[model samples]
Target: MDVPEEHSYERVKYIPQNFFETICNDNPDDFETELKKVIFSHVDASEKLGQKSLEELIDYKSQVLLKDITLFQNEGGILNKDIIDLEKKRTATYRKSIEEGLSNKKLELANHQSNKPKDVAKLESNGDYQKSIDEEIKYKRAEKEKLEEELNLATKKKSEQKIKQSNLERISQAIDTFQSQYEKLKTDNEPFLKTIGFKFEDAVQVHIDKNAINTLVETVKIKIETLSDSIKPDNENGLAFKIIKLGEEITNLQSKLDEPTKRYQTYLDDISKWEQREQELIGAEDIELTLKYYEGVLIYLDNELENDLAYKREQRKGVVSQLHEKKRAILEVYKELYKPVTGFLEQYKNINKDYEITFDVSFRLKDFEEKFLNYVNQGVKGTFYGNKEGTVTLKQIILETDFNTLEGVIEFFDKIIICLERDRRPGQGNESREIQSQIKNGFYLDMYNLIFNLDYLVPYYELKLGGKSILQLSPGEKGALLLIFYLILDQDDIPLIIDQPEENLDNQSVYNILVPFIKHAKSNRQIIIVTHNPNIAVVCDAEQIIHVSISKTQDNEMSINSGAIENPSINSSIVQILEGTMPAFEKRELKYTLTKNNMHSIPV
Candidate 1:
């Protein structure tokens, strides 16, 4: 209400961002329309026009009108209904002033048109220009005064412009220095980032995308990790893909070997049965000849088929060896990749420093075991095994196992993922091919990102106030801190009406902590609170004491009695209410006497 230097919509952005949402949620049902208008005043978003709310109000780059816009100030802070209403009031005042000016202009124009001929006649008649000498001089002096005011305004503007230019120069120099240092940091870190991936993109994306930096990072990480599953077996790739194809080839050979082996065994059995029955046959000679012929055919078959089986087995063995070689090569690649990370971790650990963002964030590089265990314990929501009810999980095994190295931990995770893929994949179709997945262990956790390489972690964003996290602080302590922040640190001079400051505080706590704070805070802003403690009200010497009584029987009528402690009636009311009655108050007064240093107890 007091500050009208800026537009109400713009000024409202100064308020805490959450306060807007809270107030909107609390708004009456009928004011829903007004709430929407208030929200849109900051960024009028629509399907057709996008969000160019202030396009009409603000000229973009002094030329182009922005068609799409989003609020970037104060993390998307905007006007509320109250601010919009205030803006409306200001607009109405401006419109009234403009209308008045137009009316005055019309009247002045009419007077000028009517008096023009007379003015001309006066000017022609012996140089009598419709004014006395004194009046004409007064008129010239008034004109000179207006011109002087304009000149003074121009001089003031010139001085202000020079100051602005000087400030801009300093700012520009600081910006250049910042960019130089940032480029150097990136250059120093370039080598470490290249081991896991060939490409390097920004760690953060556009701020306007609400789900930008972290979300995009996670999405890209998942896609990169799961990229192997997406690739068809027909797709040509390196060692991993070759290993899968060789595995399938060996499996086919194993199946083909079973056919030849089974057929050769059947042929032997028939020849043996024929030999056994030949001696007892009526046509012994013919049977013996048949057996001999069959035996000879079996000999030929054994020679050809045995050679074929041996050749097939040898070929499968060669494929298996190749598969093993590919696997070993991959392991070697993994070791090479891990060296940079391990080195990065060691370097990061050796250095000790705190990097501050908008909040207090502490980061430390987690070792192989610590990082692996944390992720596994938290659970992996893999393609085959998800972190859901009844889902096959790594958590159980993770809790049981004590990991020694990153390689060993990853090997175990790879086995688990491989087993899950094999179990879940169906036979004889494209679905089975996903078993050749590339994501192994913690690679999905932005494996190539420097943060991953360093294995730096904060666990969660532990925002601390006074070196204590919110989780560590009790409700009273949290409230107290918030109150202190609002009163002392926030410094906005916004009205703070604390409903029961001593709600959770004990009497001693109120006196020791809150009483002194409120006393000091009162000098800055009025501290209004609903408190019943005599130590707070009486000791602090309240400027006003209000005795409120609610009568529910009489249509919930509220009666308020207000006065200072100096007033007899107010003092009596305070004693009666706070001390439970005048008799009890007098009894307490007789027992205890107030003093500067300490209250003394009288002997009973």
Candidate 2:
């Protein structure tokens, strides 16, 4: 394997090249033949020969012949050959002159060597010269050692100076910190000291000395050490009595402070409780006011009951007109979404007629009265009446009656108020008497009943699907209808994730309705579906497919292998496990071909 020098492979023992190399080694003869064929195919003999020929042609074309031309012509003209002969003779003359100069140089070198100075000979023969040289070298060595000693001494002084400078800087920082702490403590305690009729400066002076801070620190340290030692088995008389007296004083002071702290905490607790009680009373008062307002409305209605009936009839006509307009808008939405619902349903089973959706408005007196009673009961429980046991029952106020007009509804509530006053609870204490008075005045029940009846007067709507009510459908059919409705109603391009959407759907329904819908919807928004069925994955032509395999060994250790569809091992596993071998795929292909032909043979 040819590994790049830039890569550091300490743990990676094998690469893809190693596998290929092993395969090649196992079949060396076949590998060698294939490698040689591949190498030789890239090498063209004709191209190689053409390259050589082109090089030779360029060299031949670059050569130039020397030609002599006459510059001037005269009678008995000087020929070109004569000029060439003269130039050759001149060249020979120059070469001979250079040779003569070389000979002179050789002689000069010999004469100089023979006439050398006597000092040069004497120095070569002198025996004391080597001794002198060794002495000088020894002296220089001593001088170097002296210089090194001086350098070491200078470095030691520099290091000592640096240490002294660092200690001075640290001492300066400690002094600054101490000064800042003193100022902050003084500022924080000044106000408290003033409130207690004590001077802050005098209190600080008793424990601290500003002029001699170091002495103060030393004194405090010595006191702490002495105190610690006296508390031990030895040194029984070392400031033990002073420590005991100070401790007794501290305990007395703490005892004195605890009384006020407890009082303050008690005050806070009582305040919180009172605040909560205040909120409850406020809620009760609001409920009473609401009930009073309802009572007044009922009285007014009772006084003008016959006269308002004619006015209510006109209002009902106008409300009906508005209700019709809202009904048309709802019908438009139903009409728009109904096609998708029917299209989805028809994918499983074809229907000759379209699915029908109709909306109707009508008054349900029984349901209205039940809801009115519930509202009244809720309002009563939300008031102070609920706090008392057996105060009143909602049924007493909500009577069952056939009221066809607005005047009849008001008269019914008026009768309820009169009965409540007549049957007011008899009490002895002031609190019970107050409750009886409130009941006599008509509590929140009157207002609650009036609001409930007014709300019930609004017409209710019923939606029918395929000539049947929505409540009549089974769970699966209802789910299908709702899913289709949401898909049609959703206009934003947000991703929708569904897990096992095909659980309640038949394969035919999944393939025809769900698959086609997802395919079309994917263009506008992202759809992610988790399914175990291959039909959904393959029919949808999913961009990416992941196959996860979990297997346990003999030791019950599970190992998982997950990869994309493009992986060779994953492709093999999918084909074997999901497609059920190659034969199944072949059978499917044959079936599809027959189906396609049958469809083509049918008339348009």
Backbone clash count for every predicted candidate, in the order shown: 0, 0
**Poorest 10 consecutive residues by lDDT, candidate 1:** 67-76
RMSD after CA superposition, every candidate: 43.5, 52.0
| Winning model by TM-score | 1
lDDT of each: 0.42, 0.43
Runs with alpha carbons beyond 4 Å of true place in candidate 2: 1-472, 485-488, 554-604
Model 1 lDDT tens row, 1-604: 6666553443211223233233323532322233223323323133213434322222322121111111111111222222222222223344455455445544544554454321111122122332243234335434544544454454445455455555655665656666665566566656667776543345522223224344544554454334433333454653234445544543343334334343443444344445434432222222332333334434434455445534543443333333333333333432332233234333333121221111222232345433443333223333333334213333444444333334433454445444433443234232321221323554333322211122232122222344575446565654454444344333334455665666556777566556555665677766666665656787667798887878999999998889888888888877877788899988888666544225344444
What is the model-wide C-alpha lDDT for candidate 2? 0.43
The alpha-carbon deviation from the true structure for residue 338 of candidate 2, after best TM-score superposition, in angstroms, is 14
**Candidate 1 displacement at residue 373 in angstroms:** 10
For model 2 the TM-score comes to: 0.27
lDDT of 2 by residue, 157-231 (tens): 545545555565566567776777678878877987899899888867433334455554455455545445544
Best by lDDT: 2
